[model samples]
Target chain A: MPSWPTLRLRRQSAPAAPDKPLATVETQHGQRRLAAVCPRAAAMGLRVDMALAEARAICPELTVVEADPEADRAALAALAAWCERYTPLAAPDPPDGLFLDIAGCAHLFGTEAALAEDLSLRLQRNGLAHRIAVAGTAGAAWALARSATAGAPCTVLPAGAERQALAMLPVALLRLDARMVAGLRRVGLKRIGELARQPRAELSARFGPLPVLRLDQAYGAAEAAIAWPRPPAPWAERLAFAEPIGTPEDLSRALAELARRLCARLEAGQRGGHRFAASFLRVDGQRPAIAIATALPLHDAERIAKLLGEKLDTVAPGFGIDAMVLEAEETAPLRPPQAALADLGKPQDTELAAAIDQLANRLGSARLWRAAPHASHVPERTVRRLPPLAARPAWESDPAVERPIRLLRRPEPIEATALVPDDPPILFRWRGALHRVRAATGPERIAAEWWRRTPQEQRPETDLVRDYYRVEDNNGARFWIFRAGLEGMPRWFLHGLFG
Target chain B: MPAPASLAVLRARLHALQPQAGHGVLPFGDPRVDACLPEGGLALGALHEVGAAGIEAETGAVAAGFIACLLARLPGIKPLFWIAPACDLHAPGLLAYGLDPGRLVLVQTRDDAETLAAMEAVLREGAATAVVAEAGRLGRIASRRLQLACLKRGTTGFVLRRWPHGRTAAVQEATAAVTRWQVAPAPSTAAHREPGPPRWRVELAHARGGIEGAWIMQAGGSSDAAHPLRVVAELADAAPAPAVRPGRAG
Candidate 1:
């Protein structure tokens, strides 16, 4: 196995267990003893340095863990996922430090201390080695964590007491290299307070400028930041279950609540999010979330629920989820509904959306898309998918030019026998049946979009330039056909038929 | 002298949505056929047709064929619907009769039973001016139910018959229709001057509103290229017994 770069857990192993084979290291009792004799002692009295065999002589039973730096990192990642339920800002405790900004939520649980206690308790239950500290400044919190009395929370040093609060901590807590710490210790620097008192230039010259700068952050003398996990996105609404949800119905009910809340929030802000993300936070500390992204922004709760329902199959609530949260991402200007009472008397947007939503559920979402014209002549690029959250648009407008009422996404190729290079072919075969062209229109030319294309565009995958024609066969049947690439020799494909 | 108020009121209510009252109001396949329909036109909802005709036996496409000819002359942009449960309605054939595809909606369904029901539903609530469903003979109750539906919606209901195995549950047994025509093969077209596909020869087996029997007329076509896919319908007074028999061998 490849050994990865890791934080050294300890200098040596602890004493061995009396009952089990694996050995352990000694703690502050300072004498070697079997780990089985008192495992609790290993947690407390064991020193960071003590060879395994030497400690085994004092206590025979000890359990040793071959250090797993990788697992530790993964566990921290899982912790991050768990934290995502609370806020979008959950991240790894970088190099063994977790910084959380629970600013507006302090009063939600009564006080910052209560929030910390709740957070610490949850972490403990999930088997995490965590200690939380909150202060007016990031610097104060960082300094207080390693400096405060053991087993106690952060010491909230008064505004001027930053230097005093940091004074007693060992220089090891200053986050410097061992060589620098040893060098500082050898030169009569006893405590962090002593280092703080040294002349600025002298310390910079003697121990280097980095340590002094870090010290400033520790003492709240300089501004510090707790880098958030991911950027706090647009809108998020959370639902706390009075009774935890285990059934899909329960989850759906929770979704309705979140949709209403989120929609209202969007309405109040006069905005709407194009994407709706619903997260089900599992009791096992694993969050499985599913999101539906619309091509448009809408706040209709029923529509939102339907879109989310389209994706509900992806969420497997293993055992059960204790809470559910919904977040809206990528917001846009909210549209005031213009549908009149005349429309309400008939089938409305809600009904249409519901019907389309049902069909969309049966057919895959990708299969359900409406297209509108774009500013491109490249036929494929000339149309784009209308956003799902948007209302249906009118089909006809002023005719700047004649356009086909029917258009096919992909032109179906015809099996050709009679070859005509210059003009529309007199006969074409489709669906194994022959159609003889009787009346025909022009071989209209459309050039390639050269300016908007790249090197890859030079070689079209199908490599055909198209000149379209409206042809009525001998049978009075109308067909939309095309001859490829206008400027030169073109191929043919039967595109569509007028219905 | 003005008609009495009570008498005028009686006449209006009696014929409200009555197809007989609307005769001569609109054009159908000759006024004779139009007078027979309750709506005096194709029932506007959804119409279904099932073809049991072979190229040698031209009568199979008769019901659908008749409707197509009638609808071809329909004016305005009102859309028409034609549904078939048997997958036998040909699109090109419809276009041959001059029914505009833009204004005509075609739907293929599973079987006569489903198609009949679907067509009935569409007729009840849709914009189709005609509802035609094909079934093996429709039972009296079924015909009455369909008739009531058409009457309420001001639609024309045509229960196009298919060859049933037994004493059918057909509209013939269900109600005395305004007109019931027996359609069969006619002689080859003198214009085409070749052995060609069978053409229909129609005979009026029953008619309450028009001549009971008449000369069978040729079904017409407009030749762009002269599709040559034609069916001839000439009216006759009392069709041959076997011709009117439900599903009897020709």
Candidate 2:
């Protein structure tokens, strides 16, 4: 196995509480005990698993805060997100640290040494005290970053040199629980080198399989891959300038150039994209991104540039933008546009796409929607609201039946006068208005959705039938009202109005 | 004297502004109705105002139905956009007027401003063949904006005035609309015995570069009928003759 460039950040929780000798205490067995100690508390000889009383006695001025494992986890996750600017593969090293795979990214900062130096300088400016170590293996890097002295804060081990790095670190650095460390200590093993000297079979038999597995991982003899915060995006292009750009004209020019380059690559690959996002990395460490989506697949650089230009006002060029990256996150296979005849007029399809893209960019994609027909028998559920570009079933309308030009969001109850128990209404009073019926017709019954009811040994409680009527008032007003429920004691509601 | 010379120059400029050819008119296919309109038909790239003859729901429904039928009769598969604040329209009633549910796109806006904006956008984009909007309050500036947008693309627009509180005063206000119409449900024909078709008395109150007249029209017929509807007759208001009674002077 060869070496992998891994960066580890250790003691990730202490920077949150600067200027305080903090000791995190937890309630174990109904008694307070120290879970972890910060650097200042550690300088006072406070230790993990020490009783709170003993720690208080040792350092009377110590600040004791209850341990929050969740907060520590969240801080590590945020750090991992920040580290993504350096490498695509960045993951939280659980309760306290982060692991970054920067194998090919070191050259971006000129060299590995420069990368480590830059990281150190940035963390210092951010008020976070970190001990970072770059090693050939994540396990070896983790062990070295935690146990190595302050003078050797940034340790870079050569390829296949994990054995030597693990040999110098303590056995406790192997990520073992307290019982495993105590078992190894009882067996007279104090360092990783001592454990490596024993036969592998004998070591496993004495301390279970964990010690051998941990040693193999740290020695670069086992498979270990860090789980990144998210899988890498399919396509991304980034440009970093020597000097930050502040003017809108320059920004627009740069954006057009990037669009051209990205579209060229997409053309070469025979692909088109519906979603394009450009992230502006400001010098102040604030990332502002603008995303534009088209209703149809498009790869024209000029069109993309125009759409992005419309959103340039939203990107605050605060301090100045030092770098910009463009990504075609959602893409599809390109279909060649049909050749146009001179007398055929402009291609209406492409014109519609351009107009839709412009409107969606301004009004938001949610505001531009189309009603799609569904197979449901329920009137309201028969049509669904969907994005404009979403594929919908062919509209099959029953013209023989009458439908309202507008349907109320919900049916409103109305008082009505009827001749019989199941007959149509003669007159109705709605919204505090009484109307005399001039003519009336109907009793169009729509039964309940019986398929929705399961085979329960019960009555038809889930099924309610409706008897609709079309009536004209003496004032020449028409309405579509319905009687809910069946037979006796039914309620009348105004469902919709007729033209 | 200066205004007349400037008006002549403005007329020349306006003549130059009109698009070439007659590709924008939509004929009603009836001589009585089409002859009363400029270009011998309804013009695209313009805003038209439609309102009920009375404040009753039946009259408003007839007005809306007439526009719906007109939009459906256009020679294209393009969709129709109808923007309104409070659409008390029955979907089935629209079908009775010959509009296909598949070709309909409804936009229920919250206020008159949104309605106007949506109408303008739809017209400017030419995404829909026609945009019909129901508005309670439409200022002059908003109507001008809609007309300009309609001119950008040869899209037709219909502004149906459905004033709240059943007020008809807004119908008489000065508007930028190229045409104004009033629709009311007329008495049905008696000889058919069965419910023949829905009839309406359509009055062309205002028209640009054309004359105004009133017509009696039918909108629908039975399943076996050849045509959906037709213009049955044209109406003319008759002047009353002076009376010479025994006790009164003529």
Candidate 3:
């Protein structure tokens, strides 16, 4: 197997001053200790895990700062995302590292050594102190990139040589806990080579399976998968420009070309994308991306370009973009268009789908929908919003009952006067206008759905009963008003409007 | 060339240029109302405007019902697009006007610009049989664009002039609509002291090449029956009150 593993280690420098010896200290058990030290501090004999007071005495010029592990992790993750320009399988390995699975991608950069050199050169240009190592296994590359035995900043171990390369490294490089390393050292096994020479059954029986599993992983006898930060898209197309382009026209032209290529691939596989995302990688390391979703699966290049073009203005080309990547984040199977046996001159389904896609992309998908009838007695709960293209559910309105043409989002409270307790209001004041009822329809009692009510709403005093009335005012404007509660003074509310 | 012969040739050329002239018309199924229109029906592949009259303009309930009835009268089972600034239309209520709720694609846009844009897009797609949009104001240029889009796809478009709550400024701007209507709720004739079928005082304020008229129209007979909005009586245009006012006993 052609196994290619890439390991990246970044040594964070103090942001204040690079020349001043700096040490980040953290409180542990009521005593502050050095969590990390800069290169200048290390050269001045200040070490991590040393007491902050002792370090200050050893190097009085040492600049002390509080350690922020969370920010460091977030910055590492962002760097990993930026590294996707090289390979989509780049993942953050936490605290201060990244793992890039560039197995088949090395040829694009000429060779494995050249790819590592390019990566390190870019890191150096960005003023980051980093070490990169390539090996046949992730465990071996990770160990070699951090160990002092590599002798060089960038190391490339050929395939099948991980066993020999990792033998001379200390047991600590096996990714074992500090207690386990100390225990192994007490047993006279200070190096991985000595541990490999010992009987595996005896070593595992003493230290459990962790040591054996990690040792096997480093020697390429087992596998270690990097936990990717983001799931790789099923289909993606990337373009790198010889000269950076920053104009809107150039960006849109590039996007259209990428979309055309992506759609062609989707067509060949008999699939359509439901969601597409385009990422523009700027020279200054800013990755601005825009995404669009369709209501129906589509593989049409022009349609995808049109939808994405509307959002091109939102992408800011900071210092010009050097590369671009388009990915189909979601896809589904769709057969190519075929001639129907009988064309009835009706608009094809795709025409509606295209219109829906355009509107949804611009105004948001939630804004467009088809109303479906829900099986509930409550006026508001009786209707449900469904996706525009969803299959229409069966709906049958009861002609015997009258429903208002316009239902208010919320019922507005009104003052009313009635002759009887259960009778319709003779006069009602709504929105500061009094309407004398000329004609009326009876009390259509719609009770609250007991089964759907929550525990807090099930109280007796909360009265969810309503008696609705269809009343026509003297001006001929009809309204659907209701009285809440079954007892005491009736509370009236105007719920809907009728023609 | 003879004068009569030359005039006939020019008329034919004009008709040929107007695409909607060949698309036919949408009849209200009532002869009295259809007679006021030049083509004996509302022109297809054109834009129409409907606004609520007087105090009823605030809610726009009556105007929405009139539009729903017109959409129901359209021939075919094709889907209808309804674009509005807010989604307050109760689907169940539309059934009363003979419009099936299942045949509706409702789009709630953020503002007037989005509503008009969505309407134009839907009309140009030619997938929907008709499109109804509730916008507070319609400029002349925007309405002309909507009409042109309809002409391209032979889709009918209706713009309902509606404003937000408590803001009842009337829309006075002229548009390129083939017909303009003002609908007000009229008192229904009481049947045994109960409210009968809803009535509307519908006024055809403008028609492209037809005479303007006003009528007191009642919406259908039975709830299940497809009552093609029948006219009860024609108004004098100057009269404020009809003869069928219910007595206020309270």
Candidate 4:
């Protein structure tokens, strides 16, 4: 049998305790003394759920405000980001929950219960109601916390040990339909322990795959991966808080621990990541987390912390936070050391890169990029824009033939009404401006490569030649102009201007 | 008590923090392009550029594409930054040649002028080997100012000029840039042929250490050295008959 908290707040964000609700306290002045008021509270003479209007008749005034889900989400995300200090695999469970995969990390954290106690104490300090449970499988832990609350020992099942681990958690932990649980109840199966003794075939025959699946999850037959509110982030560190943190400094220090771990991983992999996420969990059943993503994948602790700190103002911990998570997404291989001893060290590159990363994190990744190279001869086609720090370039990978220092995206047609047909243009009109050719150079005839030209590039053989000329304008400023025709015969076009 | 020159050199070397690339770091390819870089390549630091006449706002010519091509020639697994103005930078065409957007940083600024100043500051940081900026006009003093900054940080900066219709741009005689180039759209043949990259007619207008105009080289593509660049007019071109002695035999 399940018991909803008989006590409810006159106004509560979520349905107070679906499995075992929390006692309602309208105005909490101290930790131990929570003035109770609710349906069950009324029955107990606490009268929590009474309308402020009616409660005023019963009592006097009640504070009511629409729940800010955004705040809750931010806080949770901030907690998750903070959790990154422990492990990168942190995610918010939603409404008010967190899913941290501590696989292979139990020893590092000492023990799951210790980790849990750590969370509990932190939440208590933050004035939050934290119900933390660790189980062999996410389903088992979820079941244990939601179905079996308060002092119900969280059974740890060893590898291939879900059956033993989840045997104690109630069947309700499986989250089966109420009708199914009722049906099972009618059949005299109540606790998870009762169902565990039943044959799998009978359970399958009676409840279908769901029962079988949940049983398997509880017993390690199959794994139940929790559907995280956000995608599972890649993280390698975790810090279980001894005391929940409310200030930015505490949050920063916690994040630093995770950052250090991440830096180690990055150094080992010889890679860096631009986009990073940090999540936090508050103790007040409110989950507010912050995610900081950068434009460039970076590995400096101070810079990253500074960036996250800039966004700290955006996070409102409401009450306080218990745990924090930080993880990195969007990674690239580390740059090979190309340091050279020049006269003095320049901070521009690193500073700019860092600034860009912060801006990219604040803006969407799509908005920040570096110009990329394209193959098209068209000036515009030759240049591409891509996300910053997103590539391992092949630019310096060959003995390249000397290329023109000047390359334009599109050819500008010039009006050459006055050039002899058989020579480089001595004069031409372009962009409604006239340019007189001062010192003339021979036409460097460029023909399109036939083997590679597609139908898009096919033209009559006669127009195949491009007679280029380096003509110094009367102003002594040079212009690279070309004529689309045979030697001497020219159709002028202005290409590039020399600076 | 004068320190020996060797000792002074050793001390200088010892003070260095960021280690230099070992011989094994032989650039994967394109050593020539690397040769021009401070660390035999774009150093793992900042680079900057200054542009004038709203050049940064336009196709990002002075500020964006130039850097893309320069970086494209290197093959290390690092990132590049196109710090425009803390805003306003697009890189679609850049990826066609394989510069991943994920490895780029575009800092679009609110305006063109501000972007240049910020770019100078970024270059002074020394962490990046390059920084490019676009300003309304980089006069001699301004170019000199930026050049000094680049020299101090061991970074390189490219200043772009936007010359309006028929109006000549002001040229700065003093600066640290070893070369100045003007990028414009290359000419294309109207005749049908296998399509190829748009050919650019490079004009080396200025150079400090190397011969001016010596840098005029063709944009190498799928062609070979014998036919390094396209020479058009096959049908209409009258080839000089191969020089041959009149056949005495008869």
Best by lDDT: 3
Candidate number that wins on TM-score, 1 or 2: 2
CA lDDT of each prediction against the hidden true structure:
0.55, 0.72, 0.83, 0.52
lDDT of 1 by residue, A1-499 (tens): 0011111222122234333434323344665433221223344444334655665554445455544446545655665767654555666654456566666766767777777777777765543444566776565566566553645543434456767666877776676778998999999886888888889898999877877877887776775655665567668888766556788787887898889988988888988787677888897778888877554467778778867876787888887788787888688996777878666554334433443344344333544344444676655565455544344333333222334323444677885433457666778887556887665666666666667565765765334457777665554445567776655445578765432
For candidate 2, the per-residue lDDT at A128 reads 62
Encode model 3's per-residue lDDT on B124-154: one tens digit a residue. Answer: 8787889999988899999999999988888
Q: Candidates' DockQ values?
A: 0.05, 0.23, 0.56, 0.10
Q: Each model's RMSD to truth, in Å?
A: 12.7, 8.0, 7.0, 14.9
**Order by lDDT, highest first:** 3, 2, 1, 4
lDDT string for model 3 (A76-177, tens) is 787888787678789988666789988888998999999999998887776666778999888888888888766666899988898888888899988888
What's model 2's lDDT at A320?
91
Estimated TM-score for each candidate:
0.54, 0.77, 0.87, 0.47
Flag regions of model 4 displaced more than 4 Å.
Answer: A1-174, A177-197, A201-213, A219-222, A229-234, A238-258, A264-324, A328-408, A413-416, A419-433, A439-469, A482-492, B1-134, B137-250
Off by over 4 Å in 3: A1-15, A149-152, A159-164, A193-202, A335-347, A419-422, A450-464, B1-22, B222-227, B238-250
- Tens-digit lDDT track of model 2 for B126-213: 8767888888677788888887777777778999887654454534677788888877766555332222345677888878666677
For residues A1-499, write the lDDT of model 2, one tens digit per residue.
Answer: 0000001112443333455567778999999998877666777898888999999999887776677777667666766766766776789887677888889999998877678788878877765667777887888888888885536547777788888768867798988988999989998999999999999999888889999998988987886777887666666677778899978898899999899988998889889988999988777667789999988888899989888988898999998988888888899998876666862653266655665577577666665555666666455555666665444225554655665555665777899887887776667788768976666557677776778765656644323677777666654455667888865687888776555
Model 2's C-alpha root-mean-square deviation from the true structure amounts to 8.0
What order do you get sorting by DockQ, best first? 3, 2, 4, 1
- Please give the lDDT score for candidate 1: 0.55
